[model samples]
Target: MTGCGRREPIVTIDGPAGAGKSSAARELARRLGFRLLDTGAMYRGLAWAVQQAGIPPEDGAPLRDLLERTTVELAGDRVLVNGRDVTAEIRTPAIGELTSVLTALDPVRDKLTPLQRALAAAGGVVLEGRDTGSVVCPDADVKFYLDADIETRARRRRGELAARGVDVGLDRVREEVLRRDRQDMARSLAPLVRPPGAVLVDSTSLGPEAVLRRLLEEVERVRCCTPP
Candidate 1:
């Protein structure tokens, strides 16, 4: 994935919740010297704004109105909505649930999809989200559908919450993970699917370093095959 005199490739990593897409995307971007686009954070930022404005989650009118006036910015690791920092605020289980629900809405996707594309327009970017490959960047140079066993994913989610000092039981976390998967797959608009031409990476037993190595290998393989 060297840039040199050619355009850098756009890489997309898409998968269900707790599949380690975020961590891998960040590290892969760092290793490749490309910008990391956390599309999930954009939705979370909107969810935080919706909560603050008391906008009903299922109500389209108010949500649309709020989105019309909203500005979600992903600056490094921080997420800002309407010029206010919300990176930490939107990471809770509650906000995550709300984000899943809000993302199923047409108004929300219509509002954010273009922003996501524009951000990756320059080509040197790694985008991670539920639909980054299937919907947001279907023509991305390299796309990966990273997944793990449900049990592994649930444990990962629980560990992440515990690290945040939010202590949650494994059973409860597992249920939440399952619920999110159902919602994501059942959504009418842009349901989570492994896009055409995407390489599937099962990371049930692989560590972060191993996953990064595999992703880098695939990227390099593509780079070699592509004409400059």
Candidate 2:
């Protein structure tokens, strides 16, 4: 899909949490020589700021002023919140819960989606998020929806947390994953769904390398028909 009368290539990879979209998008961007935009990190940064400002997650509403003042920057692998590096800080399970809330609020979506659009306006980018293909970059040239079984996703989330020293049990992780999945799909705004025209890739048993190879094949197929 193309926007703003621009024809530059935009690739959107949307998926459920723990589906490996983030890691795959980073590698895809590098392999394709495109910019990488982790839209989830943007929400995480905003959630971090809101949490820092003592905002209550139970409010169930967007704090306009707090959001307006917040700035999220993605510099390679580092994520900056208001000029402070909060990359490692934003990945916590606590923040993950908060981010789910933040992404659900209409005001928050209104504030952040435009920033995401501007960043990818020039295209030649890989965007990974729950709604990147459906909402943020609907006109993206190529879109992929990566998915895996719930247990697989739970195990992956558990492994990730363990590596980060969080050490959450698989049962606890499974519960959280199911909870977030319900929240994401049931939310009024930007609910997770497979975007139209997106290629579905089930990674239930596929490794990251296999996923990347399949994605590359799709990109090559798209490139073949694109006018030079």
Candidate 3:
């Protein structure tokens, strides 16, 4: 909902892995007529590049060099790195794991966080990521911390994998989700946290559409409260 003769509001969605941030952010952006900034995909694209170049996670110099040369672009639903489309390539469990580690590093966050801010500088974007609300867009007009029970989250992730034809056991997926949660919350640089004033939405019992509707309601509430 763009305001006439006023800047569009910036919305941030932050949550742990498997919490349905991606799907919610996409639909929310569509309904609001705003751009969807999937920050996780950007990190995954970088991780995929690192994996392909054979760069170890602990190696800082090489990672810095790669960051200097890399160009990550979000074109519609596709993700491109250095002019190569890696949308499908970056969604694997391996990239997810790597992305967790790489994103924790200071260099990685330092490199990407600015780009994320620049993308949303105009203020008509929906940014979704672990740190979008806490770090990337702390002053966003509206912020949401979406979450769900671990069991529900794991099952959702498993279903997503199944849809992609990459079958994985529930137990393994649950463990992976736990591990990512620990890493995301424990990381020193920009660790995941609910931003001040962010509205929390527990999706443990809510479906995607329900969560989207809730977010829309909150956004509308914020918009109505703000002076034109």
Candidate 4:
């Protein structure tokens, strides 16, 4: 729907892993002339930092402390972890698997919520993450919750990871996806769940083109109605 109360337009695309959130967000951003924010990548950067600092995934205090001294700067597709470019480094399965844990933490969510808000508030933006609509920018003009079957998402994840040269079988990828679902949905602060009034688009049967077309239709309606 239309933005209830905002001077600028913001689109929040939130979904679980491998649900085409990133690709859809990118396409929507280009179509809408909005900046793109891959919030999951931000969490991946935090997970990489925690791992580098020898902090256990469950140690919230240390992870929060480590994050306090670190800065996550998103410069386009480049995710800067403490001023270092580790965008490609954090895409590994090991890092991706651990990132759900980081995103589950209240401390981590507390740290990044402000950053996510500031970026969206600056101007028009299409942000993709678990809680983009629900937590990060609930007041966004359009909220989309993309989804697909676990198997479909797993196959896509396997292809993506393998393309990046991390050879992993589809079976394991399915398991990893299921595990991520549990971890993401069970997370305390900001879980991977739907937001009220969000348009849920299932990509299981629809291709990206169809998804994009439908999304554009929805976004255009919102854009056209937003008060100046």
- The model with the greatest lDDT is 1
Tens digits of per-residue lDDT, candidate 1, 56-100, equal 997577888898899999999999998888888899999999999
Question: lDDT per prediction?
Answer: 0.91, 0.89, 0.90, 0.85
Q: Which ten residues in a row have the lowest lDDT in candidate 2?
A: 1-10
lDDT of 1: 0.91
Tens digit per residue, CA lDDT, model 4, 1-228: 245455557888888888998888998898877899988888888989988998888755777678789899899889999899998899997897789877776788788889888888865788989898999888778899999999899999988898888998899999988988998898777778898879999999999999999899988887777777
Better of 1 and 4 by TM-score: 1
What RMSD does each model have against the real structure? 2.2, 1.8, 2.2, 1.7
Residue 110 alpha-carbon offset, candidate 2, angstroms: 1.2
My TM-score estimates for the predictions, one after another, are 0.96, 0.95, 0.96, 0.94
Arrange candidates, best TM-score first. 1, 3, 2, 4
Better structure of 1 and 2 per TM-score = 1
Task: List model 3 lDDT by residue over 53-135, tens digit each.
Answer: 89898647898999899989999899999999999888889999999999888888888999999998887789999998889
lDDT of 4: 0.85
Ranking by lDDT: 1, 3, 2, 4
